[model samples]
Target: MKKVIVISAHPDDEVLGAGGTILKHSAQGDQVFWLITTNITEPDGFTVEMVSERQEEIKEVEKILGIQKTYLLNYPTMKLDSRIVNEMVPRISEIFKEVEPEIIYCLNRSDAHSDHRYTFDAVMSCTKSFRYSYLKQVLLYECISETEFAPALPEKVFLPNYYVDISNFIEKKLEAMNIYASELGEHPFPRSERNIKALATYRGAIAGVEYAEAFQLIKFIDKE
Candidate 1:
């Protein structure tokens, strides 16, 4: 069984980004782990601790995805700087030793969100420098909030090279996101049914798949 890890700066990212891949890999009996890099309990204008509320969202997601093992870095959300990742070098070095993942997925470095970019850099640095990190390739995936047009999708579009048909797992993704009832506060869009389905269909057409999940291929393994 291969060892796989998902690193997300935000909570719901694992599902929105590559939930199908995660499910497919796990169904193959691969050992899966999550490296959640933030504790984003508090938001600026929100009255409740969005961070703490996020834990429940995560729990509900775990039920659908069945990733029993997880790790949270507990660094404050968006507080990570280059210096902090440097400080985390040794800590990540230890995880590298422990997990020794053969394949890895993480946030895209060019994401619009600062936290996603920070986490992406941290994973890249860790993979490059860690003694045990001889990973063949590291793929990049898009989180919901981060992938919505703007800077994340230059030209107001995302062109993905790889797509996993998640039509089967799409319902689970929606179910997982539903657990975040607290954080879905005041969403301009209903968010329950339309956007995600539209994105999956849109990306599927581009990738020539039916009901797909999209990811930006930053690096790839040469199966040769």
Candidate 2:
């Protein structure tokens, strides 16, 4: 089985960005792993109960998605910037060595959130083909709110060149996302169930599928 990893800036981002694709990999017997870069901590103004509840949500989603394992860096939320890149890269690189994932799905580098952008930078640092020979592909998945809200500069645009048909797993993705009750909101809210499904439907039409997830193929190495 191929090893796959999904790296996100926070807990709900994996679900928001690539949940269906993650389920597809698991169903296909690929060893799927999660790397969450930040956490809600008491120092971040979150109550102890809030931090505990977020952890519980992560566990529930892990069970629902059949994640092989999860690695949490536990960095403070909203504080991941270039200042900590040196500290973050080695820890992430160690996980890359441990997982040896052939495929990686990460947040878009140009996302609106500073956490997402820095997480992407740090993850990419660990993905040099010569250093991580097992890595065959790296793709960036768009988080609804962050991606769409990014500055309208051409270089910052999220141009999706890859699509994964997720018709069979969309409902399950929604199910997993719902575990993060604190993250979702009513319609018009980008992370809402309605908006998530709507984006899938829109992308499905472009791919001529019932439902799908879109991604930008950032890197690919053909070892053969």
**Which runs of model 1 end up more than 4 angstroms from their true locations?**
41-52, 150-159, 185-192
lDDT score at residue 68, model 1, on the 0-100 scale: 53
Candidate 2 lDDT for residue 75: 91
Which lDDT values do the candidates have, in the order given? 0.72, 0.93
Write one digit per residue (lDDT tens) for candidate 1, span 48-70.
65555677777777767768578
**Where does candidate 2 stray beyond 4 Å?**
none
Instruction: Give per-model TM-scores.
Output: 0.83, 0.98
lDDT of 2 by residue, 1-224 (tens): 89999999989899988999999999999999999999988987999999899999999999988899999999999998798877999999999999999999999988999999999989989999879999999999999899999997898789999999999999999999989888899998888999999999999999999999999998988885
Q: What global local distance difference test value does model 2 have?
A: 0.93
Q: Highest lDDT: which candidate?
A: 2
RMSD of 2: 0.8
Compute the lDDT of residue 3 as modeled in candidate 2.
97
Q: Candidate 1 — worst ten consecutive residues by lDDT sum?
A: 183-192
Q: For candidate 1, what is the TM-score?
A: 0.83
Task: Report lDDT (Cα) of residue 93, candidate 2.
Answer: 98
